[model samples]
Target: SKMFYGGVKPEMVSDKFSFTEGPSTDKEGNVYFTDQPNDKIYYWDWKTNKVIEFLNKTGRANGTHFDKDDFLITCSDDQGEIWKISKDKKVEVLFKGFEGKRLNGPNDVWNDSFGGMYFTDPLYERDYWVDFKQETP
Candidate 1:
């Protein structure tokens, strides 16, 4: 069991975030993750092996998956929406609600091969919300 990890001991990479969630890898092997309570996103550089802050004010993004085009598709749930974040840090809201009603929250996202996405709308309310209510049963 000594060689369980090739003798590599566990080391703390970074710390100091309210909560972390949703890690997705890019085409180049770098990993991106979120700190939802702090509204931030960070990535681990494949070449440098360093954690880098990718974005802030991320709308309480929880889960993420990369699209075919390398865009970081995110479940930005602050306002219950899905956002596609470009490499240049451009944010495009892909969805907001259903039937003109606000979604409870987008908790996760997955992209299909045919350029479509499937996401989860959970009613787990957040303190940052104004008046939490489930728009969908």
Candidate 2:
């Protein structure tokens, strides 16, 4: 069930790149979103109707989820790590690798009621990579 605010209009904040990925709301209904390209997290308060940077250098954080314990879980795409953000804003890496090699990139994630988490790896190419040479025929 999707909920809607009474009269809030979605307006552009700036020409800046938001690069927003997963958006998660807290128990207080405050929404948190990621700006992966710029490596920042933003917060949109329902009561204030404002967006503010919650964190910086988020490790290219992508998908975000909140656990039953109120900890913020984020899938960091840059380093392929899942993080647990405590209430005190302390971040800890919950997972770094699955087998041995680094994951491609955590594109999205979710948590089950049974305390299990699932994530996706879809980063096939680096954002800064450039193909300067073509295959020789």
Candidate 3:
């Protein structure tokens, strides 16, 4: 059996982000995370010990989860949509709006074993939004 370093302590990865949220990992142990205020997703390569931008202009992604197919499902708060990102970095909108009204804002997402998706929508004010206002639901 392989023994690991039991005394290892958590270390700071980076301090340059405005605000960080939604951290997930792939099967290869590569970590993916979002910086919503910056509208970017970062990739932390386990083998390289380096962090780089995986995606930019990401629609202010907040939360993310990896599906069974290894695709990345993310909450895009900028437009109240859910996005699916492929391995090739192609982005497709999964959920746009609920009924006729736009969603409040997608905060997080999860994939079930039955191939179902669950996400959270919460109303929050954004400085970039000028065309829409929050409505009572």
- Give candidate 1 regions above 4 Å deviation: 1-10
How far out, in Å, is residue 125 in model 2? 1.5
| lDDT leaderboard ranking | 1, 3, 2
lDDT of 2 at 22: 92
User: What is the C-alpha local distance difference test score of candidate 2?
Assistant: 0.78
Order the candidate numbers by TM-score, best to worst.
3, 1, 2
lDDT of 1 by residue, 25-116 (tens): 99999999999988999998979989999999998999999998999999988899899999999999987988998878899999987899
lDDT of 2 by residue, 41-126 (tens): 88888798788778888888889988877788998866767898886679999887766656667778888778888888765566
TM-score of each model, in listed order: 0.89, 0.80, 0.91
Candidate 3 lDDT, tens digit per residue, 20-121?
Answer: 999999878899999889899998898988898999988899999999889999999888889999978999999778887788889999998678999988
Question: Which residue runs of candidate 3 sit more than 4 Å off their true CA positions?
Answer: 1-5
Measured over all alpha carbons after superposition, the RMSD of each candidate to the real structure, in angstroms, is 2.4, 5.4, 3.1
Better of 1 and 2 by TM-score: 1
The lDDT per prediction is: 0.90, 0.78, 0.88
